[model samples]
Target: MNLFNDAQSRSDSFTLDTAIISTRVYLVLLCISTGILISYTALTPHMSTIIIKNPPKKTYENLLKEYQSTLECPCSKIAILYGSFVSLSPVYHQVCSSPFISDEWIISSQGKSFTTKDSKAIQSFFIILKVYCSLTEKTVSDAWNIFSQSVLITSHTISNDELTIRTTDSLNQFESKTATEFKRISSLIQSYVATMFSILESNVQFAPYQSVNNNSSVNFKLMPTTQGNNCSCALNNECLQIITYPGVTIYDIGVIYTVPT
Candidate 1:
């Protein structure tokens, strides 16, 4: 009976030792697993963030190869006005701004014996000239306003080379069309003025010049070549000639003369 009790006690002791060993092994394995999980969680987000932030930048050549003509860059200014990109400035005839068309000049010229009929004609001529200058500027401005409305830039986002080419083409077209229209209007004005004044009559003089200082009457010669300094009025009807008035005061007058064809 004593031997059996001792054997039972030894068996219980061995079982307790085995249970303790099994529990320790399980705890060690759990600690290793927890450490691996924590490491994975900490490193994953950092690695992913680095990848996202430091993406490789593409070169122009690389982008061109990938996207070809389909690639377009955004413009800084999306809706720019036509006036911002293109401007129209009309250079009017110099005669319109000269002193010859002034009230003082007209009043001074009125004292001549033959000035009654000639003065009226000259006044009419100057009035028409001034009107033409003003109207031309207004008309061109109106035309530009209308043209700007119609100018649809479909390329809000476009390739650099293509944008440049399109802009150049548009500018060229506008200039060419505007110049042609201006020339046409000028020809019409010239024709109307000539017809009204009977400029073709041989004996009828349009502008008679009497020198104030010399008291000499100078006949106005018909100029075969309407322009000087290698410039032709035929090419640009707005061509100006500088006329110096050497009398009481030396006045350098810039004048534009339109001869009827």
Candidate 2:
């Protein structure tokens, strides 16, 4: 009976050992599965962040290229920058400088009314003359002289609201004597505008001019033709007339220039 008891005890001990080994194996498998799940979760978001930040190189380059092209024209952008806030009258009419000045320089004028007529005319002429003279082969003084004489003509009128202005060469007369001068002037204007705006992306040499004595050449600020506005150009052909309303006029403003010796 003692021998039979000993064999039963050995069999029980063997079953207990087997259960402990099985429990250890299950614990090891659980640990491995948990580690893999944790690693996958951590890595996924990091990979997503990298993709979002870098994107495709080509996409970034194309966007930059588009942005630069939009600013290629300077005059148009400038016109918009200095826009007027006038409720423009249908009576607004003037010689279109678009053919000589690029379309980019043309902007919707603001604050259009009879009250601001003279200011508008002076502003318009200043803009056109500045751009035009910068591009011409002629010196600023000579160009201004030629422009006043050949292109712009202003006459006094009896009406307060109306002034007289006429262009020597109409839009259709590209071959006329005045039109030829306009064409030559335009070539320089385009070059200067492009250079000033860095469109050429190169160094530019500007045309030179001699200093004029105040006595020899008169400096003028354009004056708007309003009621009782006594401003007049002594020599009609030597000044520019800009339009404020359909028939209104003003001349290259006269000013006293103090020449440096």
Candidate 3:
């Protein structure tokens, strides 16, 4: 009887020991798994944070690239809708109330009402007036360009007096007897003397901010030029060209230095 009792106690103790060993092994495995999970979580790359390492913006060429890139519309993007609205809508307020300033800087103007007495004269007048607006815009653009080169030395802030002087100088040069000078100055400047005032109207201000200035000249090798970028020499049109990066393509715009009527 004693021997049987002792055997029973020994069997019970052995079972308990086995369970304890099994539990210890399971606990060790669990600890190792938890450590691995923690290490992996700490080491894994955080995709949410990103850094774009572009060079500093310190030069005119770099600033020009950034400015052109940011210009969502040189004039306004609403022109397409405005034109469609003008064509389709019976609502004059919805349509013609806001006129389109073309990408080419041509504005739909409200000219004098046509007179029945002079149909051909009226038609010619309309054409002339349209041409005048374009010439006016080009004049402003030229002043901006001239002033931009000047701004490289002077303040980015353009003064009214400075604009006036530039305009006078431009106009005087235009009146000069040299045909090439006149043509060049005219191509370089605007038509309405007032555009000299207006293009400088509340625009043309830029200062280098460490926040957004990327001073690297556009890698023309990486992003090569197309025939369209040479539109300034070709014809007076807005040239939009594509620039390809790794995964995406971007567009940069070009302008014709002159507007021919």
Candidate 4:
């Protein structure tokens, strides 16, 4: 009876050991399967989608009209000033046709006190105007209109809608000048743009007048031009993007300028 009991006990112990080993093998297989699934998931690439938003379309006429409106500011008035005729310089005209505007941002006496938010808004407007001025087929007169309009917009907008200063008749005499006189006025305007935005000053390469020939008038061209995606002008911090609607020609500067007849 003792011998039989010992044999039965050995058989029971073997069965238990076999069951334990089987469980361990099952656990090892489960771990290997889980690890393989994790590795496969990591190696796969998921598709991602992005959406872009754009601002309202702004035009020279709309901006001009906005500035031309009456303002309550006693210190500000709106006036029209025209620069002298740009001579018929084909090369210069070709340059003008390209979209190019000043990139400098030198704050004026008035601009120095602007709030940070106001400054950024005004800067954004300035950038928009610069690009617009460069892209449009504007003569000196056209450019002046756009510039003056922009000035008024900025002045009024930054002033918290209180007052705006426009070019009243006080500066009419300054605008009408002989080629020589106009050249000086142009220089001042150019200087102002350069002082504020460093872009246009360098791009405008002027051909000084030649006294030997009456036909020789001061001519200028826009340079350092780029095209396509290279022409995108936006502040790094801004979330806005510019989209050229289908059928619209996106203008680029530094390509070609035309001399006015």
The better-scoring model by TM-score among 3 and 4 is: 3
Candidate 4 accuracy as TM-score: 0.17
Candidate closer to the true structure by lDDT (higher is better), 3 or 4: 4
Error of 4 at 86 (Å): 33
- List model 4 lDDT by residue over 33-101, tens digit each: 999999999999774533223312343234435644542222243422222311222123333333323
TM-score of 1: 0.45
lDDT of 2 by residue, 1-261 (tens): 122344445579775566666767878898999999999998884422112244344654554355443322112122211012112122211222322233433342333332343443433444555454454423333434433343222331111122121222321242254446767666666455434323221122233344469567644543322222442232221223334343333443243222110
**Whole-structure CA lDDT of model 2:** 0.38
Which whole-number lDDT from 0 to 100 does residue 207 have in model 3? 34
Steric clashes per prediction: 0, 18, 6, 33
Tens-digit lDDT track for model 3 on 25-90? 878898999999999999996755323334233443344455544322122131222122212111
lDDT per residue for candidate 1 within 170-194, as digits (tens), equals 7778777877887898789876765
* Candidate of highest TM-score: 1
Which numbered prediction scores highest in lDDT against the true structure? 1
Question: What TM-score does each of the candidates earn?
Answer: 0.45, 0.17, 0.19, 0.17
The candidate, 2 or 4, that scores higher on TM-score is 4
User: Model 3 residue 209 lDDT?
Assistant: 35
Which pairs in model 3 have colliding backbones?
A: 56-215, 57-214, 57-215, 58-215, 139-189, 139-190
The residue pairs that clash in candidate 1, if any, are: none
Off by over 4 Å in 4: 1-11, 54-261
